[model samples]
Target: MRLYWKVVLINGAVLAVATLLLVLGPFSVSRHPVVSEAVVLGVGLLVMLVTNSLLLRSSFKPIEKVVAEYDAMFERLEDERAASSARALAAQEAERHRIARELHDDVGQQLTVVLLGLKQLEQRVPPELADELAALRESTRDGLDDVRRVVRRLRPGVLEDLGLPNALASLANDFAEHSSASVRRVVTPGLPPLSPEAELVVYRVAQEALTNAARHAHADGVELSLTRVGDRVALVVADDGRGFDTRTDGDGLRGMRERARLAHGELAVTSSPAGTTVRLEVPSS
Candidate 1:
């Protein structure tokens, strides 16, 4: 039977017995009827209260068990989701590294050979067409440079060789050179060494934040700070520019958020007309 109906039936039986004893049985044995009836009524009420407590406990036990099971299932599902996201991020990084290597080794070498051949052709050509050949050679060199930059973007060698701090420093330096904005970096010394995957997530989040600050916020100045917060490491990127609404804005913010989640971290972004700040916190171990 349903828990509610079971509780109701049990209480009704207790009340019915109490009522019969208080109304009929007590009267038959009583000489002073008024006092005896009062005493019997009080005893019946006390018995009813005790019986109700036991019945209620039994009735609610199954509901409590079901609630506990549901909570356990939800926690398990959340753990699975986090693990899945981490695997996907790792796969993506591996593919990017492979493509970057191919671009540098195969495409870059071909472009270099083409540039060399062009130089020889320029020497053979007459002075009348020399300027045109020179321009073509320069254009080819430019294209080669572009390809190399793309390779760097795909997978930076510094990230693997120098570690996350130095990689971020290099990124900041490059951003300062390319953009009209100024970038200041403050990295805490003696930080706990993060796993390579976690480092990559942090680096990517910082990269995207800087890109958004320069491209969308049009900020004149930006600050990137890394520090240790309790058992976690925190990376904060703030810009002094018009801010964007995180809910409605670009995919760059969303990408950073996903990367943070995959790293078993948390990301918080706050924006206002005065400025914008992006912070990432991941466990330090």
Candidate 2:
């Protein structure tokens, strides 16, 4: 029962016992009672108070035990969930690395050979074919560079070698090279060191967001930021362009959310007539 009800019950019982004794006992000899009504009532109240205090004290142990068990169980479950997520992220990263290696060693090498063959043919072919061969050569170069860039961004070797700052600079430079707008990256120092998984998540999300801004958003400029807020790290990518409605979930948006979720973080995209902003927060704890 609730403590208030228990107190009431105990007080009632004490009052009943006191009243019964007072009425059942003989009357006082000098027209006064031996156990006065005030005395009986006061003693009953005191007894009720003491008994209630003891009852409450006894109840505390069980409550604490239940709370402690709940906390322990919740903690264990959380650890399991976090571990599962980490494994999934590791698997994804491994696959990305494998694909990048295959592109660099297998497909990339073959493309280089084909370009060499085309150059050799251009030298031997007729003078009338010269213009066509030149066009083909130029096209091949652009296509190969584009493919390398896309593959590199999908899985950047620079990120593994030079860390996030250098990787972001390279990534931004690549984007700016391909587009008219200048892409700026500001990586604040003194930020907490992120695990490899967290770094990948941030980088991938920024990459996609920048690509979207340059290709579709028609933004003249974009800013990418990486910083720490208290015990949490934050990544913000903003663009000054015709903003998009965030409620719509395109492939890029879905990819961004998956990256955040893989890193055990939260993502939010806010866009309006002014601009678009993608914010990510990942807590160390």
Candidate 3:
């Protein structure tokens, strides 16, 4: 029983014993009624105190066992869910890498051959057809550039070669080169290393945030910052464009959340007319 009920039972027992002693006092063995009553009351009080103390301690023993079991079950479920999420994320990344490789190797090679053929045709063609050949060559070149950009987006080699910080700088530089928007990166020096999965999460979150700032927010400039905050690392991407309400989760936002979740981290987004800021925090551990 719980302590509350135990105490109530003990009190009731003491009261009943005292009432019995008083009711039978007229036939008591002691010579004086007052002395007999004092002795009975003293004995009853002592028994009540001892029983209450003993029962209170023992009552919660079962409760402790139940609570411990519940805690263990909760942790087991959490670990299973985390494992499932990690597997899903790993599969997704593998698929992306495969697609990137195919595009770069198969489709990209075909486009290169087309460009080379166009160059040869331009040299051998008559002067009247030169303009058409030139136009075709230009179009093919642009398409090739687009394909390369898509391949880079799918699989960034810089991320594997130079680590996350340098990879982020490269991403920002590419974004600036392609878009009119200015991108500024602010990174703290000597940032602690992260697990590969954690690094991917941080990189993807920043990439998506920048894409939203350029495409959805129509921002002219973006600020990306990575810093150490005590025992945690924080990534913040902010834009200067008109922002949308963050209450809705678009595909980009959902993707960011999934990445953060798989990394055992959290993401927070705040938006206003002035701009939007997406922040990710992960434990240094």
Candidate 4:
């Protein structure tokens, strides 16, 4: 039987028995009852209250068990989801590292060779061909630089080598150079140490937030700050520009959320007409 119906039935049966005893039993209350009669009525009422309590408790046991089971199930599912996300993110990073290595070792080297060949050929070429060769060499140099930039973005060797603080500072410099926005970077000294996963999550989230500020928000000024908050390290990126709705889930926002979940960090975004702020807090090592 459903819990609601079972409770209703139990309560109704208890009330019916009490009503019958009151209406049909030998126990009668006078308008002005004697002390013994009053004591007897009080004891009966106490017994009825005890009986009702026992019945209701028994009826609710199944529901309580079911709720406990559901709670455990949900907890297990959440753990599994987090594990899956971690695995996927790790694989993605590995792939990116491999691609960056190949680009630097193979494609980047080829471009460098071509640029050098063009430089050598420029000297030997006739006067009419000199301008064309110079332009071609410049284009080749630009392509090599572009490849190097892509490798840098894909691998983030700076993060691995210099740690989170310097990595973030580099990111801020890059953003300022590439975009119209002026960036202010603040990294608190002696911040708590973070696990590698936590550091990566923080870096990626900061990178995405700055990219959004540049590309979408058209922010003139951006601030990136990293500090220790209680036992956790916090990263905040704020911009002064037209804000976006936080309710929307673009690819970048979703990726940030997934990374935050993998690191067991908290991600919060507050946006208004004036600007937007993205904050991430991760446990310290």
lDDT of 3: 0.85
Model 4, range 1-285, lDDT digits (tens) per residue?
Answer: 987888889889888999999989889899999998999899888988999999999888888999999999999998788779778998998899899999999999999999999988887879899999899989988999999999998988889889999999999999989998899999999999999878889999999999999999989999999999999999999999899888988888888888998788999989998999999999998
Q: What is the lDDT of residue 272 in candidate 1?
A: 93
The 0-to-1 C-alpha lDDT of every candidate, in the order given, reads 0.87, 0.80, 0.85, 0.92
**Which segments of candidate 1 are over 4 A away from where they belong?**
14-18, 21-53, 128-132, 174-181, 215-220, 228-232, 240-254, 264-276, 283-285
TM-score of each: 0.75, 0.55, 0.60, 0.77
Query: Taking the tens digit of each residue's C-alpha lDDT, what string does model 1 give over 1-285?
Result: 988788889888888987787576734445656876677657767878998888788889999899999999999998788677667778888999999999989999999999999999987888899999899899999999999999998997899999989999998998898899999999999887788878888999999999888888889999999898887889999999899887884678767877898778999999998899999998875
RMSD of each: 4.8, 7.7, 7.0, 4.0
1-285, model 2: which lDDT tens digit per residue?
Answer: 875676577657756775676678653333554567557656656876786567666756677888999999999898777667557767887887888888878878887887888999987999999999888888878778876986775688898889888888887898899988777788888878888878888888888888888888888888888888898889888998898878889988977877787788899998987778989988754
**Total clashes for model 2:** 0
Task: Tell how far residue 115 is off in model 4, in angstroms.
Answer: 1.4
Report the number of the highest-lDDT candidate.
Answer: 4
Q: By summed lDDT, which 10 consecutive residues of candidate 4 come out lowest?
A: 78-87
Which residue pairs of candidate 2 clash? none
Range of the 10 consecutive residues with the lowest summed lDDT in candidate 3 = 24-33
User: Candidate 2, which segments miss by more than 4 Å at Cα?
Assistant: 1-92, 102-153
Best by TM-score: 4
**Angstrom error at residue 98, model 2:** 1.2
Query: For model 3, what is the alpha-carbon lDDT of residue 238?
Result: 94
